[model samples]
Target: MYISFLFSSFYMKTEYVVLQILVLLYDQDVLTEDAILAWAREKEGADESDKVLLQQSESFIQWLQEAEEDEEEEEE
Candidate 1:
C-alpha cells in the first residue's frame, strides 16, 4: 500500500513511469523481487489506488515473473 502511494503520488505526476521506477528500485535493492511479487499479487484489502498501481505495473510484474527467480538469497 505504501509503495503504491509513493509511486503514484511522486512518480505518476506527468506520465506513467511506474515500470521504470520498479526496475530501478528492484535492481538497487530498495525493493526485493519477493516484495514486489507479493504486493502485485495481493487482492483482498487492496484499495482502488493500490489496484490502479497494480494494473499500471502489469508489464513489470509479467517480466519479473518470467525471469529466473530461483537463486537463493545470500545471508548478509
Candidate 2:
C-alpha cells in the first residue's frame, strides 16, 4: 500500500512525468536525444539529471533489444 501510494505520487512529479512522455514518444518513433534531453532538463532542472534519464532510456532500449533476441532464439 505504501509503495503503491509512493509510486502513484511519483507519477505526479516532473521527472517521472517527463520520463513517461519520453517513453511514449520513443514508442511513436519521434524520440531523439535532443528532444528527450530538452524535456528532462525542463523537468529535472539540471543537465546532469539528463544523463540519468539517458541511462534509464538506454536501459529500456537494451531490455527491449534483449527481449527481441530472446524471442528469436526461442523460435529457432
Candidate 3:
C-alpha cells in the first residue's frame, strides 16, 4: 500500500516517515484526537515553530468541525 501511494504522487517530496504515519492512521483507523495529541506531544518539543504548528493544527481542526456542522445545517 505504501509503495502504491508513493508511485501515485511523484510530485510531492513526501518523506517515507510521514507517509508511513499517514498509512498507519488511515489503514488502521487510528486517527483519534487523543492519539494525535499524544503524537504531537512526543515529537514537538519546546521549539517555537513546533508550538506554532501545533496551534495552527488545533485551529484548523476546530474550523473544519465547525464547517462540517454548518454544512449539515444547510442540508437539513
Query: So what's the TM-score on candidate 2?
Result: 0.36
Per-prediction CA RMSD (Å): 9.4, 8.2, 9.3
User: What is the C-alpha local distance difference test score of each model?
Assistant: 0.75, 0.63, 0.57
Per-residue lDDT tens digits for candidate 2, residues 1-76, read 9999998687557556656776788778887644654554465555674566555455555555576678889999
lDDT of 3 by residue, 1-76 (tens): 9987877664244444454564467458778644565655665676785564455455444544576678889999
The TM-score of candidate 1 is 0.59
Segments of candidate 1 deviating more than 4 angstroms:
1-15, 44-49, 68-76
Q: Estimated TM-score per prediction?
A: 0.59, 0.36, 0.29
Candidate 1 local lDDT, 28-60, one digit each (tens):
999998899888778436888658777777888
Using alpha carbons, what is the TM-score of model 3? 0.29
- How well does candidate 3 score on lDDT at residue 16? 43
**Candidate 2 minimal-lDDT segment of 10 residues:** 32-41
Candidate 1, position 57, lDDT: 77
